[model samples]
Target: MFRVQKLLVFEFEAIYEPVLVEGPVVLVDAQGNGLRQYHMALTSRNVVFSCDNLFKNSTRRGPSDEPSWEGRGQDPEIECLELVSLVPLECLRFNFYRRGDRCLMMLSAHQAHQHLNVKEPMIFEFGGHNFKHHFWYTWRERVASIRVVQPRYSEITGSSPFSSSDVQLEEELTVQVQVHPRPIRSSSGIFVRCYSSSGEGY
Candidate 1:
């Protein structure tokens, strides 16, 4: 059975202009042999931001193997991350703000998922501001347990004017879940709701 107990939140400000950013976001537990694999599904709101300008990249290091590249400047392992087939969100929005003549963009109602081989540590990076606000279950019958590490937030300077000073927030509670591996389940739904300290849900 898979049970959820902890939830992690990572919030940070974008300081650089939109560029190709890539890295791992989650780490998968590799059984014993010291081998690891990672997977990620990415989606974004259809705002003016250029999707082409955004890129996802990954690098894996094993005990004996040199670091391998997943995308760009490549060694070829077909680095393209697979996108899962599912119902798209009904609506999407991008919130924008200005501070001292600089434009800041925030993704609203944005969600994504990553699947990794359960035999390796998972690490990832993103090109833009990635806000995690929900979790979508695809293979509900195959998962036996689920745990989320509370995400931490930090701002990258020279990207935007938004700072940690612009907002006040609290540490999010972690979520852990236990579930049955089989029973023919479809569509297990979970969403993250974020609110400001002032009681405003964003």
Candidate 2:
């Protein structure tokens, strides 16, 4: 059988690493009871935010037909929000290890602020001391984008898998944004790790 197959392809036309303005920030989704983590990866061109909400266990009728929420059958929901456009803000990081306290600073409010909501106190342990702090996002940094997928429709009198007349080429570059949030801060500026999981610095 000789027939045409609607094999289409699409990929990132171009990708550029963003400048290190301030980064590896870990924000928590205050809107959710679970308080999911939203990691921040800052670049000159964009600020990529990603999160993974993997439920350890899901409730489902198991082999015994009994409902179970103890690591049964389900996968965690994952998503990412990227801003092609970006803006520089008055971002600051501080760590009082000796005092056992820390603080977060973001002069320009963006969507990441929701996770680090300043309205409520974010209390935790830092520098071996219990610390409590608040954050506020005056503005939400969001960019609008649309994605669509469809079968490639074309007409060819005779098309087969053996046909070599036409060819579709594709190139891919998988960028795994590595996020690292250091608890300690220095007097100079942002505290970036030297040996990250990827062993590559941006």
Candidate 2: the clashing residue pairs are 18-43, 18-44, 19-43, 19-44, 57-71, 111-141, 118-135
lDDT of 1 by residue, 1-202 (tens): 0101000111111111111111222221222121222222222111111111113344544455545453446323233332221112122222223233222223333232112111211221221223331121111111111111211111111122223543222244434333222233332344433221110111
Error of 2 at 188 (Å): 41
Q: Which candidate has the top score in TM-score?
A: 2
lDDT per residue for candidate 2 within 1-202, as digits (tens), equals 0000000001121332322322223332222122323334334223333333232233444555544345433221211122222222212111111122233322223344433233333221211112122111100111101001111211111222123542211233323323323223223433221111110110
For model 2, the superposed segments whose C-alpha errors exceed 4 Å read: 1-13, 18-24, 28-35, 53-100, 110-202
TM-score of 2: 0.24
What TM-score fits each model? 0.20, 0.24
The runs of at least 3 residues in candidate 1 whose Cα sits more than 4 Å from the true structure, single-residue gaps closed, are 1-61, 69-89, 110-202
lDDT of 1 at 167: 26
User: What RMSD value applies to candidate 2?
Assistant: 23.5
Backbone clashes in candidate 1 total 45
